[model samples]
Target chain A: MSEAALLHNSLMLGAILFAVGMVGMVVRRNMIVMFLCAEMMLQGVSVSLVAWGRFHNDFGGQMLVIFILTVAACEAGLGLALFVVLFHRSGNLDITYWQELREENQAAFMDREVPEEDREKTIWPQLTPSGVEPAANPEEELHRSRV
Target chain B: MLTANEHLIGSAVVAALGLWLMLPPSGERLRALGLVVAASGLGWLMSRMPGLGTWAADAAFWSLAAATSAAAVATVVSRNPVYSALWFALSLLGTAGVFALQGAQFLAVATIVVYAGAIVVTFLFVLMLAQPDGTAYYDRVGWGRVTSLLACACPAVIVGVLAMMLSSSLAGFEAGTATVAELAANVRHEEHVARLGGTLFTDHLVAVELAGTLLLVALVGAVAITAQDRQKTDARKTHGGGASR
Candidate 1:
């Protein structure tokens, strides 16, 4: 293959890797696997960026890749935190089982007898199992239930 | 029958070798054999092409590429995180070869420092701290295989189409034709590091400082988050406990 063609082929490979990473991110249930998939995706972008930098005879893409690295680090940190919290609360990392963090909060609110208006404002610990404080007042009880 | 794209061709061969080694057969000796064979083949190919180079330099580059690819593939396929980290370091070294071949010495070294030195070390630390237990080969393979296959397909298709088009439009084709010697000479034109450093410090100083500050903050955050010893105790309450207790 010609040099240009070869380099272009590598870039295409990088793009395909990026796409697979994206799809994995969307489809994977395991948080750790999701992060790995994210890294894979980021690798694609990084390779393409560097390839472009070399191809264009410019250093801008390399510089941008530095920022990308920074962002990836930040993402890993945040994702790990979320993973830790998820594991602590749910004891499983399954994305499907993570519905408690999603729409199931409404069901929890209904079980607690929280009124519609107070449900949005009040924040409750999703994993606070069987901890109850005596109702001080009806209004406070409603709010606490939502919490 | 010496082609101008000898190094490029060698690089592709090495890339293929690296990808091929990532498949199965996790034996170190087997892996080493595959790597050696690939390197030897690269050397033989270069030797067959007249006017290419002396045996020593050709062998050096070929072995370098082979080693790099081998290490990278090993990292991806390894079950042990520590082993994976080591392999990652090797892979970075191989990627540096590409930069070097392209005549980007500063970029090559920067890749080594940033990726191998910083990124891989941090990953190692996280892996150690987490200590992800048990056999995870099935999980990694099932996902990795599907993703890798899907990823390889598009590029193959695109390259095939482009090649057909280029073949048809031969006169209009603008494939790069710089040889290894030409690229090396171009890269060594002057003190590239000095120019890069000057541009980075002066024109991009603030942004650089910002990155530094952000990294510092992250370091502090990681330390703070990981330093906590107790699972349930609040920081204030824990401190209130008497030493005698």
Candidate 2:
């Protein structure tokens, strides 16, 4: 393809990716989802840089993208580790669990009303009770559920 | 001609409406409608890209770009975190294809390896530990009302403004053709990854070293942050017989 055509395509794709990521970052409540959105934004920028570099007829864009990959790897490692710690504290990945960390004067966010779900009985995979079904002790059953 | 201002504006509007509807806490009916609208909007935008260069490359670009954008939307909107992670991987692969099309062979492979191999696994491991039996409650819900209104509009604005900027940016520039020696003086004449690496080592070696150091620091930081009093778990292990605790 001609450089002009490629530039147009790459820039447009990058824009869409960045925009979608911004929306996801703002609206999604799960911390992992939020992190994924951030990475998506990075991908958008990388696409644009590559397009410019290609248009200019050099590998400069690729070089920058390599660095982006490095930083992203670091971000992934530390971010996921922190996520584990946060999950231990909140018992779930919901960002709302950390609302208390918001600026002291800011009012707590009122959650939007979710339309009621049908609450269908989801069929979860269960092992055939192989040993002392539910393990005699109720507390043991609780521990088993954690896995 | 395909990506004229009016066409871009129309696409941005349609996509914005779709995204607004898709954000959670809305009824499932609206989310379905949103999916159709958003897909069409993105499809129209992709069609606007002029693909006259060659048949085969155009075909690949069209298919890869479409898959990448669709997967991107799915990654954001899927209520199940596991499904989201899967969708994100598909998107990553599609992006890698785009990179390859643009002639960044090394970056493409690096993207697939570092992202599909590492980041997604970490996300899944975290999700496996944190998820309940089904979709979590928060995954089914979006942000509050005021936040939603503002957030949902951001993509449309960005797409529209970016479209205008791209058109303008193309006006004053021409593609440069660099000879091998021009790009990498020290390396032997070759194409693809060889040239990429030659440029890296000759010109940007310092940045590469710094990146390595950053990776090391981040590794140590992750380990330190996740470290805990091992004796606590050890003590529990002894008391509980350690079989399945």
Candidate 3:
């Protein structure tokens, strides 16, 4: 049980944690899961930071962790804000729904009945390239096409 | 070679056991067992060293920090945002321990208050508000992750190289030195608040004030961006409703 042994343990733990996070990030399909993976990665770095700080008897690493926490707070705030916006604009939280929101992209076969309320909030009408008159009830036109 | 720090050996063993219980129970159990055994051995060795109580304490702090960080990673990668946020808070607490070991008691407490208490609470708040759907999220963005990883690789390599060089240099200087102990003792004897205040005022005065101002501005911006006009939106969902609208 020497200093080297302690360090080796720290390194091993850090590596395993990092690998788990990476695998989760890669394999997970949910946005929330992806966020979790990113958090795991952040945790890995924090562990390394504390280990390095102790190994060298420096406070700089501690200070850096503080900064990282602040950045994480800000990131979570903005990310959730964006997620809310995406969810509201689209009926579903699925990423596939997001492609319709992407600028300059036309959905190949998304013709579906849109409720009047949904039509007001929808962005697809504005993106349509054809000169055809705007449907009196675009929701109905969308609904009819989908059927 | 028994030392004053021998008392810490017990706590170290307990901590190692806690870690073992925290890990996965499958193939990873062997690795966790190995870590616990190694930690126990390391604690025993530390007890045999003379005048190494502070070093032992510091090592313990680092071990806790690393464990917390690893836990955070596991949480994040679990595809459960709530779990990730939980690990993130644990990591913050571990950082507080590291700060305490570095003899910055105020900073340590502050780190916990700001990160574990405030920031993590906010993270949970956001998670609940966002209600991020997980099942179909990957179908959309999975292809782009590899590109992002490649983009991050160069910086990671550079950071890795820099850290190795720094660690080697510091190890060389600290190998057989008594100077650090004297310095640590002197700093402790002088009230930390006074020294830190004097240094901050005399040398880093502008930076300190700027940081304060920046924090204030950020606080205001967050409130403004998240705030909703009562006339425009329902009270129950003020923060997230605007984006959806």
Model 2 residue B45 CA deviation in Å: 1.8
TM-score of each: 0.54, 0.81, 0.52
Candidate by candidate, in order, the iRMS in Å equals 9.1, 3.7, 8.0
lDDT order, best first, reads 2, 1, 3
lDDT-wise, the better of 2 and 3 is: 2
Superposition TM-score, candidate 3 onto the true structure = 0.52
Alpha-carbon runs more than 4 Å astray in model 2? A102-147, B1-3, B144-146, B173-190, B229-245
Encode model 3's per-residue lDDT on A1-147: one tens digit a residue: 133333333443454345445655544444555555565566556656655554554444545554565566566556555555554555443444543454466545552432112233324545647687765876788768654
lDDT of 3 at B33: 65
Q: How well is each residue in B172-208 modelled by candidate 2, as lDDT tens digits? A: 5334534435434321224677778878998999999
Better of 1 and 3 by lDDT: 1
Candidate 1 Cα outliers beyond 4 Å, as residue runs? A1-37, A40-44, A73-147, B1-83, B132-134, B137-188, B220-245
lDDT of 3 by residue, B33-60 (tens): 6456535543453333323235665467
lDDT against true structure, model 1: 0.52
lDDT of 2: 0.80
Error of 2 at B228 (Å): 3.9
DockQ of each: 0.05, 0.39, 0.09
